[model samples]
Target chain A: MTQNLDLTDIQGNIVKAYGSSGFFKARYLFLRVDDGDKGRDFVGAITSKVTSANEKLKGDDALTVTTNMAFTYAGLQALELPTASLVGFPSDFVMGMSKRKDILGDDGPSDPKYWDKIWQEKVHIWISINGKTSDVVEERYQWILQQIKATGGVTLLRGHCGEDGNGNAVDDLPYQDASVLYEKDGVTPTAKEHFGYTDGIGDPVFDGQTNNAARVIGRGKLTRSGDWVPLATGEFILGHVDEAMEYPQTAPRPDLLSNNGTYMVYRKLHENVGTFNKFLDEQSKDYPGGKELLAAKFSGRWRDNGAPLVHTPDNESKAEWDKKFAAADDATQKRMLTDFTYNEDISGAKCPFSAHTRRINPRGSLEYGVKDAFHTPGALVDRRRILRRGLPYGKVKDETSDKGNHGIIFMALNADIKRQFEFVQQQWINYANDFKQGNDKEVLLGNHSSKDPGKVVLQVEPGSGKPPHFVNNIPRLVETRGGDYFFIPSIGALKLIAGGLVDPT
Target chain B: MSNIAGKAYAMNVITPIPWYKVWLNRLIFWAALKIPNVLNGLLTLSLIHYARWVIIPRDKFPRLDPSQPKEDLNYSYMLFFSNFNGSWDQYVDSFTFAIPSGLDLFWKMNVKYPKSVPLTPFHNYIQHNQIDTAHYYNAYPMAASNDVKSAKNVKKALIDFNAASSNKSPDEFLEDYNKLLNQLQNDFGEMRPTPIVSLAAQAVKERVMEEQRQSH
Candidate 1:
């Protein structure tokens, strides 16, 4: 029998509560079992026992279990269980959604004028389980892999950062698997993405019932704390949502949201360190200690405040930054510089829209409630989040190194890859007029591949009635390489993969 | 018994115990518990001493201890070292109050001699100089001297040595020196924490002078 419990006791929620500030690092692993019978057996054994090992494994108290199933070529079926599905989601899931609404759109072109300025595309990865290879499976695998490598792991082309360890640009270095590891926690399997920023944060939080607030009663409705309910397994895994069937997204299925089925996307994007430094140097020439200013602008906080927009380089001292309220004293002036929120300032004057900080999280005015906020199409955000798991691949090279290489391996966990992550990349940052308000794109991470020299304007002051200064010198920080989608099976699937397939004996 | 064909075989065989393996397992088990405790205890004590002596004293106002010797020999056991006053304290804290002549010897050992050399002052400074200024002259001249009684020759020798060591001309040396001095003046003159160290020293000096005054 199934037991009902608050999400607070779940493994992911517990981790989030404790992980508030200290080094926020996490790794994600994805695997495709060779044999279904063995995989199912392996997965089942671990899931049945994993709950007791939560504390030892640094997971939350909640033991997660779900089964996502899909069809392979020639009617062969498969199943997966994502880490996000097993882990209780963090509050940031909702916060990130609200912020995403600010920059994205539900339909059509977002910023029409800049449409020609930048291009946003996705790469996908498809791997064929081998030795026992099927032609249909191989065809799908090559197609997806090629796509990912070509796009930047959005589809599946192999992409590595331009520079290599010896400092020479491997003009021909093909994108490949960044890194792989052995057994996790002795029995579990896992994988790491590039770029080291816990990729799993991309996963979304879901409310179990169809009606989002049906589970919560009266007073708890609007509160952020009240929103902390365990997401339904269907939100992340495919067949887990609807136990009876499979192929939820296909034409023959009853509903688009499948049971225990999740679409995952992985990518490896290279950050141009040399280009980044040049941009910082050029931008900060006018300011004293301009490098620091650049650092503040990119990080969104002085090394201390840890909040990107709330703090700036000029007001780096502790006393100056701890301004929760306006002060009249000499100490107050220093504190006033970083005392406001993004709600108070929508313009990219203080924090550039395309900056890594802004791209990672642009809160406030961009949320759902604000005017001009983009409406995310189709699936409500509750079912559309992804878990990002990637790491830095290749040796970090210095400017003098002739080898151009190094980049992040990016991964995301979502019920629908096309609707969630890919949608965000294409419709929000890359698609002009997707928001229908202005031609503004997140200039930093946004792709400006066109010849017109990708242009983005930033308002230096909020509501100052002055025109935003257009700065065009910013270069690409990340480039897509290659990656693939893999199903992390439930204990049942692990048993199937480890044990003999169809153990009729 | 039976002595037929292959009969006379031993029925039971005796085997020796693996005593060392047993002992190793026991040692590991005991060490697992004891080693951690010992290491933790050491760490705790070091932290406690650091907090009690360094952080706490600095946080709470510390009074200048003139009567106390400059060096606290117990400092070797401490985890926290005073960034600046540690070496100075090592000298002044070892001062001898019983002998007046010890003051002259103290200056000669700590001030005139470099840190690498052994610090043994002359046995009899009284015979060398009765007046304080005479002692200063005797010590300073020699400390600055390659050979005694030739200040002019010493200056010439220093200039020659500097030129021999450097690949650049004298003009380049002066230019570089002046540039470095300018930079140092700009950076250290305003930003240096030297004033804090000097203030600490002055506070100690005042306490010593006050004691001397009271005695007088």
Candidate 2:
């Protein structure tokens, strides 16, 4: 609503979270600038090589190369940038992970200590390179590494597996190894996290992007008459009018550094595949509809095909639903992907209130509170929408003995870190009661601490006058391994930092 | 036979008038409620709808406006951070009344409240304030003086508010909030209380002084 985005000034990653970037493979390199002068040179070098939002890839043969970077508070300081330059940066970044650990719930593997040891050091730069093929990704990564070596910067942590110079198995090496490998069941391609639920289903559609038709039908609340509208762009990007019809607070000097720049919450989430499988296996035996339905209930979607549980309630319709989903046209398929709202299933008869998806993005269901409790059907949830650009790391081994380090590089981009990311994490994912269901945490993907024994209750209404089915004591499935708050600066801002021209006053 | 037929036609025409009028009356009633300013009655009804359904229901909490200069807005924000205490529900209920009441008081005091004042009584106050929770983590640290001490007090007040407000009636909750407001005013005085309370207090004080001068 404010203005058209300066695509050329913005980083490619911020504009498009790269879910559609056909770049099936990616490697994240964490770097620490050894010397300020050398770091500036390195930044300049990388800034030239970095792709802007306006970059256009020609064809399948041309590798879709995109590089975007962000700095920690220390990273800016390490580069000798002035304090004035850090104005709009969130305090979490300034306090660093060590100080903000309490609110982040990063006491476990996600603990700052277990974090890529480099992150603990005076690490300043984070470079993410993504490409269609691993070979292209490797080639680009090596060239960037060579430049860093020449410039006196050191690579702190390397995520994803690829052969080192010694030809050792990348998987065999022990470090913070995380990867984005595709999961396909024969012909159908399923982009899933280690937990086996299809991931990245309902990303928020912003204005001025392609996929207008899909955005119109899929975005915002679905009324009883079956109409929809896109969420305000300011909710995702900086310098735009949000749903509130007001421009969101920018990170200081709107025109220079803050415009088009958004904050990214980089998280490393480890999935306990063995524990999850065992719990589901044991619980499904006593469950009313067994493992398939139980998994659907937990995730709000069918594990095999990302069909929503609201659309297909039981396992009996699984085969028919799968076939229908597979046979549908592109438009029909896109509609199936995000067209459904919780209006009809207000009681959570189909999708439980505490279901992972429902909790994260309640959509229209949040309106079902006390009279005049919310502005509109989905108004309460509009501000909290995040563009998820996460990729599953680690290979899933056998269900029982899956013991290797595997999880997801959970990445989310939003305009305001506190309002969108932290609010969703703390209120919806960790705490309960906003749903008015109970003290139940999100059934899956919640911060269910072992000490707390996070309990989840599933209410299933069959409508036959019979009592609703209730499941409790759902175990903690995902754990925060490591994460940090970063301000992904605009390309121009990056250049300013690289040139050491940022004025403090 | 002709006379009998003519009499029957007249009876049929008269019979349909009441039924048509019944349907018309129902349409008029429906239109009065929904169609927006059909009559003066509809206009009044629409205003009520706007107030209850739109303004009250929406999240009106103070937000950081990108358009506004940062340095100027920080004082009010500091007060906002200083004033908050307790569970999300309590905070929402507090603001639901506090914001409107504060504005009403401000208006009564004949002070010009900023145009941005209306943003404070939001629909999703709980979620909006939860964002302030990031301040606890120092995610977006306020540059205000004594922020750390102020934050600690706010957290304690939140716990106290939750404990006090739970299971209390609306009147009971209001009384508790009033006590909290007084305690905050006493504890911080002019130095650290929320701007809302400070402004309202100043307004009331000024009014009293004027009244006393007139009496003299």
Best by DockQ: 2
In model 2, how large is the Cα lDDT of residue B63? 41
lDDT of each: 0.33, 0.59
lDDT of 1 by residue, A383-493 (tens): 223445444455444652323445565556555444446445643455322122123344545654434335454334533433333446555545543333433333233
Q: Report the TM-score of chain B alone for all candidates.
A: 0.18, 0.21
- Measured with C-alpha atoms, the lDDT of residue A212 in candidate 2 is 60
lDDT of 2 by residue, A35-80 (tens): 8888898998889878788777546555466677887777777888
Deviating ranges (above 4 Å) for candidate 1: A1-55, A59-234, A238-261, A286-289, A295-305, A311-319, A322-341, A355-364, A367-384, A399-405, A432-440, A450-452, A463-469, A494-505, B1-216
Worst 10 residues of 2 chain B by lDDT: B6-15
Place model 1 in a CAPRI quality band: incorrect
Give each model's clash number: 126, 14
The superposed Cα distance between candidate 1 and the true structure at residue A328, in angstroms, equals 24
- The C-alpha RMSD in Å for every predicted model, in order, reads 32.7, 18.5
Q: Chain A alone, TM-score for each of the models? A: 0.52, 0.90
